[model samples]
Target: MSAHTWGSLDDASARALMEEALAAATGEGVTFADVRLVEAEEERLYTDLRGELDERREHNAGLGVRVLRNGIWGFASAPVDGAGSAAAVARRAVAVAGASTGTAPVRLAPREPTSGTWSVPVDVDPFEVPAGERHDLLQRIVTAASAPGLVRSVTAGLNAKRQHKHYADSEGSRQSQHLVESGAMLLAVAADERGAQRRSFPNSFHGNTAAAGWEYVLGLGLEDEATRVGEEAVALLGAPQAPGGTADVVIGPAQLALQIHESVGHALELDRILGDETNYAGRSWVQPEDIGTLRYGSPAMTIAADPTMPGTRGSFAFDDEGTPASRHLLVEDGILRDVLSSRDAVARHGGGAGSGSDWPGAARADGWAWLPVCFATNVYLEPGEGSLDELLDRMGDGYYADDNRTWSIDDRRMAFQFGTEAAWEVKNGKRGRLLRGFSYGGLTPQFWGSLEAVAGPEEFKAYGMPCGKGEPKQWGFLGHGASPSLFRGLSTGVAR
Candidate 1:
């Protein structure tokens, strides 16, 4: 075997040595082989008036392999330290594959050999920010949250990660890529005579994670959001517990995007339909039989998976399995158009192709990382041709809700509940008093189907968010763009 220094795996000479060892596996009569390595560093900061409880960084990497003979899938993985261990690990994977045959064959659908690497774009790395600045930033938010009748506390922190991957299948295809991501989250807790209330604001720093630096925290600007959230808690202590009655509620981007994510997004994943993901995140209420004909929402409703959207957590040029990122229509004019698909799912559906699911992974001559699953990068609701004021004028009297506080849904993606953190009462075509604990409870179809209007881009904005799925747990960066949308004759009187 000969060595080829494909690329720097985070400045380690070991990367070249591992590549040669994986190359050795190619001649070993194995059915398949590829190589991947992950080297990551992370830091976190937490604060209150008392001080910082956490500040830390860590890294890990490994080579994983998969093989098949006589219908079974086998895998073996270990941390990659040098060239000798790399070749040894590949043999172990072949053994695991043979052992696995007692059950069913690990038959993977065929995919064109893929070869390439992609690096998420970034201007500044988050790790560059000093510890002092980080704490000072969080303290400001806590200070602002102090208000009468309210107890205030602020929690702010950042997470950064850089991943390097290399892949070479049994086919001639060979490729490598580097992806980095970082993000900040601010959690503020408030309480008054009524009860304890909590809300969080998060911002994911797109593809390049830890690279964003400390300056990113200033962008989160907890000081700006804390007071508003704290004020909401105090107001709720005095406001009527969101009188449960039939009245239209204006759901802002935060709440609506989550509704679309949990209901429409997850329902369209083919694995759920094939009965592979029912134990945890619930299966789809909508199915293949419903595509194109399922009246999922109002005729005005349209939604899409947008990997190219800037500053989105889910944005990627190429997925772990080397599939190209793309924008695909999941819904058009309230009709289901497509499901997120993996190489496996795409083939199972009689050669129906995939646009590349979000969280899938591939084998590296060491251990197996998860194949990316279907997920949203920058998901946006197509805006309607109406202004917020115009929509309100049309509504007569109601309230507007913003950002999610509480979310719940049944296993089948239908019948759900949600509570918003910010709200303003609208009366007679104008904004009225501020209110809290605004919840809209209903089935997925009815909620979207009632859509009367959506605010345009001027009203559209992003939710710095975390969208999660899968067992053994994989969390993906997600963006949801929506404007304040209005629904008529809504039922908002639920108590939680």
Candidate 2:
């Protein structure tokens, strides 16, 4: 983490940025206003077989202003420090509200003020290390993947993070936060006389806490895993295609968590359904009337949004608006018990209490951090009965998919399809050789309803990267809490 990215800011500087933003917004005369300062350093190391840096690291900090007036909203943002612009933003938002007139209704749930400064904990800094180490590591992995008719190209990537945030709200919520995250991605591209195929084993670890430093990157012994996975990819080039049918699936944590993130994550968002994000990200299928009544998944499904999980990408002691973070249920017993909501969503829903801080880029933080936008924190789907082996044995003949490629679902979160990097055929209750061009698709509710069993925590692990949502594109780090689990009647086919 030695290479200076956006995570390079001093805490005091960040704090001052927030204090200035809060003072600017409310002072301008608006019903409600918030600011978020997001400082992030994102490093990308893309290497070919020889392991050369295709793209250097990138990082930035930006301020965003979201304001509400007379039941309407407006937003403005720029990279430069627009400290005093909050007043203009507030007024502009009011103008927008007036222009819209009878369009979308406005509402917000009351929230308790939350304030604090938080940072991730770590021992090794990713930027501090030289880029040469990562480059050399990639080369080694690629070289090892070389063998008979098996491998073609290896593109390895290292993603390191340094996030510093400052938040302050009109309601007296003030916070300064810092966190770190690091990840590795290795795509093993292969070829046969037939065609070309690609698979990847991606992993993210270290810096999942509320406080951190350089130590996070060094902690992940990536070199060993690279060699192992690269070799496996070479072998998988000769693997078979997954059979298409209603086969039961035993999924590892990586694939299972992503399913949770896609189907459950987006559908539970309050703003998506309200059409606030329609012009930008798209709306959700879940409606206001569907809350607590829609049966989203199986009776075993118990999902939650928790921001206090410490070093996770989405974990926050207090949200950007100074609303304290909390764990809220999104689904329970196969029913849509709740959807992730911002303070305004809570108000609109007129249900119960909500941490207004749950908003993405939630405003009231430093440097135009952001106002409330719906996002998942840490999502945990309750484990099912039986062990990974038991579930696998029960499957008979199916495919085992790992890691995800491209994925798509309707705005309503109904039918969906995902491309996997690697897989194997589970024939007659046993694991088989690696496979290529693995594909799986299913509907949201039926997929979860088929949940036969979930692996214990020993088999559970965090997947790679953070989840993304919203128009104007606010991406927050979030995780899915799911163990290796099994599902029945999963669909598969060739991807176009």
Candidate 3:
């Protein structure tokens, strides 16, 4: 396929617009201001069992301006055009800020002026791949999962995105970043007199995404996994329901990824704890005072909010606010230590000024049109010294579950229930038979405290998903790195 460019403005042209917009905002006497020009493109293709196909491609380019006046903030965005559009957006943002209401001026943590360019290193840009090749790949995967009459339907798809951003701020920070995200998914469904059963490859929600190219999707081995996924769905139609009562269980990487996201990552965001998200996304069970005091989990648990891990969806050289990316521990040896914080939200930790260390470069925006907010980056559970086999051997007899099927948590992010797409009964330290409708529930702190062992780095995997937050609602792609974990005596049952 012939390569094509997607942006309307070149690097130099977009940078000039950002500079012009920043100058106009500062000229209006705003204490803080920033301008961003973002150009993004996405391609998605889907193939179904009946040889049906759906393809979508989209491209968007826009300029966004954010300004702080009299302690309140305002934002405005417009289609990327010329100097006129930039200046107009900047002026509108300033006016909105001037008319905003706030009891106190926004105080941002100190940050030195920075300038740099960062891009996702990719061997093959997905956009450069031939359209026919992409469609054929998905079709092949779907066909493999057809499974004749046993499998009623099958669907497979691939998605890729490329984004270019030019950013500038009144603080003398100027930077450019290029991002490429690739991912794919496969689903197989089977039906019997009981009900319909479904199975997914890699993950359930849009499969797994990463800050890489088509190489990431190729590495997923969907074509190879498709057959097994179909067989599993058919098997589930007759498998016994998950057992009830308490039992030790091994939580696989995919399920643990979401577990970490809902119970740990979101619960530890500084904004959520400070109640900034209560009106929309709900608040956390953790409190500002809980840091450095609460025992978040067992000593085997260590979690960090790391945005510096290369090739992960959340990894970035700098956040949308120009804060240099850094890795910091959120839970150290099971103790609550820090949080996912931003320069603005960090100051609101308590009535007193919060430390800058609380900020882990977590400020980000969904797109150019959205305002930056405190969001989780790559929150991960640090791997331990045992393999999955070792953990299962250690557990003796119990269950193994992976890939989320259903999950529900309270507004406070405390109590929760999660069901897996597939599970296995463990007998004599060996995986035995598959169990359907497997589910477990527990209180957040109590659940983590039951951790018995964690698989080593060899089993650790990073999974990415789009998380939603904010009043108008915005989606931030986040990564969660996890490994198989052994927990003692979890409450287990069938969903129904």
Q: RMSD for each model, in Å, please?
A: 4.8, 4.2, 1.9
Ranking by lDDT: 3, 2, 1
Looking at candidate 1, the ten consecutive residues that score lowest on lDDT are 358-367
User: Which portions of model 2 show Cα errors greater than 4 Å?
Assistant: 1-9, 26-29, 78-105, 147-149, 203-221, 279-281, 352-372, 384-387, 394-397, 466-468, 494-496
Show where candidate 1 strays beyond 4 Å: 1-8, 11-32, 102-110, 147-149, 202-216, 351-377
Which structure among the candidates has the greatest lDDT? Answer: 3
Give all candidates' CA lDDT scores. 0.62, 0.63, 0.87
TM-score of each: 0.85, 0.84, 0.97
Q: What is the lDDT of residue 457 in candidate 1?
A: 76
Model 3, span 15-83: residue lDDT tens: 888887887796454789988888989888888988888989999889889998877898899888665
Backbone clash tally (model 2): 49
lDDT of 1: 0.62
Best by TM-score: 3
Give the alpha carbon lDDT tens digit for every residue of 1-496 in model 1. 1112222344344446446545655433366555545444445556664555676876666666555445555556677676577777767767665565454334455657765556666566555556666667666766666544465666665576555665555555566555555666666667655677665664212212222333454566557776765665666666655666788877777677777777776777777766668897778887656755778888778887766665655565555445556677777888877666565455455433332333222111111354356555566788876787887887778888776777788888898888777668889989888776778788888988888878777777665455667766776655666787888777775646
Query: How should the candidates be ordered by TM-score, best one leading?
Result: 3, 1, 2
